[model samples]
Target: MGSNYLLSPYSLKGLQLKNRIVMAPMCQYSVMEKDGKPNDWHHVHYVSRAVGGTGLIIMEMTDVEPDGRITDYDLGLWSDEHIPAFARIIDGVHRYGAKIGIQIAHAGRKAEDAPEPVAPSAIPFPGPEYKLPRALTTDEVREMVRKFADAARRAVQAGVDTIELHGAHGYLIHQFHSPLTNRREDAYGQDLARFGVEVIEAVKAQLPPDMPLFFRISAVEYADGGYGIDHAIQLCKAYQAAGVDAFHVSSGGEGPAGERKPGNYPGYQVPFARSIRQALNVPVVAVGMLEDPALAESVVGNGDAELVAIARGLLRDPYWATHAAYALRSEEKHVPQQYERAYH
Candidate 1:
């Protein structure tokens, strides 16, 4: 028997996870009907990870509105009718002893398929293929907050163990917080985290008191003169006050990298996660190229972060958690009964 922190159990408020291994929410873009609902593809895609022994599975960026999606194929919780589809996936994940969460977001200017995308400012996403976005009116901004709360309400009905507000990766919440994107002169402009805080508070009202809420944040922007760790820490403090239980620390999705380029090596973002985890005194999930089993194990074992989110690694191998347990010589064998022969 060998000790492996990555395979150890973790608890956050009402959510109890079997291990520290998190299946990062990666968009599948497989919504065949373009109706903002999960189908067979999403069901299998997420459940297989649970069956493979992931501790937690955060579903991809599910939007609050139809036009909030990056593309029509993305998932959304705009209507009650969409609840059943997500419920099916969540139930399946639970059956395999994995907890599930949904990342609710709005694409804003990143809504590639919207006829007219909306943003905090009328800025394009620095790509020729992207369309210029119109700024949201003050009333529209308030309404957007309500939309986020509504989505959270529906997610609870669909039976998620927790909820994650996608405030990273140049999405709507990211745009509102980033100086590079939010040129608004309104209150949202003066207080960069105002939009995110509002959304957090609103979403909190819809969640169970014991259920923890996670905020996925870009620890630092890569654009020239963009906000760095100090700014991210301040944002996290405000979000923490507003009810964010933890943060998933990632970086450099606000725009293309500037003079300070993003790291392409493994565990490059772990330092940022560690910084935030220390500064805020909250648990964080370290992501970005942390696929190597040894590296993933180190992040948790070293106390850099409470969890390690695997993106492409889990994609390449559904049994990543099980395989990692074996590789690390963990005493707990995570393989399923049917797959016991293969593991042995």
Candidate 2:
């Protein structure tokens, strides 16, 4: 395929991206104090990537509630006061010609270091050291859904280009979706897909029609009796029917981390995205240790996925997409105009 194949722009809903490469949301744990708010570190960090050349930069897994934080320092958008901090970051990202997206989430059973973790059931995450989560009441679950929608509304007010529901890596939404964690016999637990579908529908209902909605899903649980790709495909179909704009395909994290493939290799989890993309006509983003630009290009060129999101690769070097542009022979692809002087 032509080198331009990797350089070509893509669209999700009405949001147009500069290229097929995206900066996958990775928790930085850099929030200001225990207040759960974004700070200059977040602004400089994300803006630097936008300035470097990333087509889209998804801000870290922002907590939707105070107790939902994975760590005390996680960013949050659950209140109106948090809007201005993110607004600054969003403005800076736009200045560099990159679109910004936020990964709104509730950690549930995965709420690390919190006084109490919450989930659909009282099941402890399958690790000895992990805390057992208290089961949320039916009303509490409904309130969490509203929290997600409220966060989406706050994101819009902050001028974020898109909103990605954090449904992956065994967080709150993932806990409800996986049979291994959601043991309740109620509407959410008895119907494995009901919880996630409800959250997506609720969030979508609160957002503007033109705003793109992205769902990050852990395609497999990587443990015996855990949910797998089949369930993921079903979830994708449900989200598509509910007007979701894209799927961020990811895997592992329900059980022991040791159960997953140890090393990060080129395009290791591309198959998950490939499978989901084929199952649904909606765009799919392939993430997970995709370090090589050529390999990422091949993923898109081969139609395995529409977008390739680089996490640690971009963290290691913010100029990843710029270098990828050179490797792909599309030197001007995503570089900011001001950087053109340095390049030449």
Candidate 3:
């Protein structure tokens, strides 16, 4: 009998994953024509990983509006016309026996291509490439929440098994919550979590009742005087109340690191995932440099995270899940029949 926890099946809400392995959403930035639609490159890039053995594949940050994209090359789901393009890739992934989700997000002030970017405050991201963003008005903020819900509705029409909201990495949602970014006299500023809560409620209305909602969060900020694990815990509590079923715990990317530089080692972010899982009593996915098969297995085996996400590693190898299965001696590797001889 195989004892590889990484190869074990996991079920959350109505989403059932064949293994505890998730292909973390990494942007392709390859959307040609800048029309917010998936092209052939995206189709092959994602479907190959599904075929390789990833249990749950999260598509890259798909913006709710064209201007919300980090760059013209990024994907978007602002219109119903974009649904069929995504459905093609999703159908291909399903054929390989993998469940797929989309990470809906907005680049906010980080939008390099926006003629005039927007944020909670007028603060510009720490880079010359980024423009000083216009602060979103109270009415615009509410409209932004609606955009998230609209994009989610399009994702459902595309036949996604689940949806993930990008609340980390200094995006729109993160900007509103982080005290560093949001500084206003309005209700959203007074209540740091109000924007995120509203967005969550709005998106939830578009999702199926049993489809679990995943939230990607930065457990700690690396910038000087930034929020830490405790603050993140409180945020998670509010998010849990608002209806987040699971957390994909990651850290940093709020801005440049100060004295608190991010760790550059394996499992550097696992403890944060463990912290949230224990604090919120909810399943969490551990990410960041956790690609080694043994290290990945240890994360799940130790109960630190319910799942492990591979980012650059999967970019380096499409068949990472299968390779890990072999390394761990998992009996249910699920290698394709054509590749059985390679494993034997």
RMSD of each: 0.7, 1.7, 0.7
lDDT of 3 by residue, 273-307 (tens): 99999998999999999999999999999999999
Q: Give per-model TM-scores.
A: 0.99, 0.96, 0.99
Sorted on lDDT, best first, the list reads 3, 1, 2
| Global lDDT of model 2 | 0.86
Local distance difference test scores for all models: 0.94, 0.86, 0.94
Q: Give a tens-digit lDDT track for model 1, residues 1-344.
A: 76679999999999999899998889999999999999998988999999999999999999999999999999999999999999999999999989999999999999999999999999999888789999999999999999999999999999999999999999999999999999999999999999999999999999999999999999999889999999999999999999999999998777788898989899999999999999989999999998888899999999999999999999999999998988888987678888888865
Give the C-alpha lDDT of model 1: 0.94
Give the residue spans of candidate 1 off by over 4 A: none
How many clashes show up per model? 0, 0, 0
Please give, for residues 1-344, the per-residue lDDT of candidate 2 as tens digits. Answer: 33865678988777998898899999989876888889988988999998888889999999889989999899988899999999999999999899999999998988887788999999887666579889999999989889998998899899989999998888998988887888897888877778788889988987778888999999887776667689889978977787688999998777775444423666778888898888887788999877688888888899988888999999999889888888878745666677778877
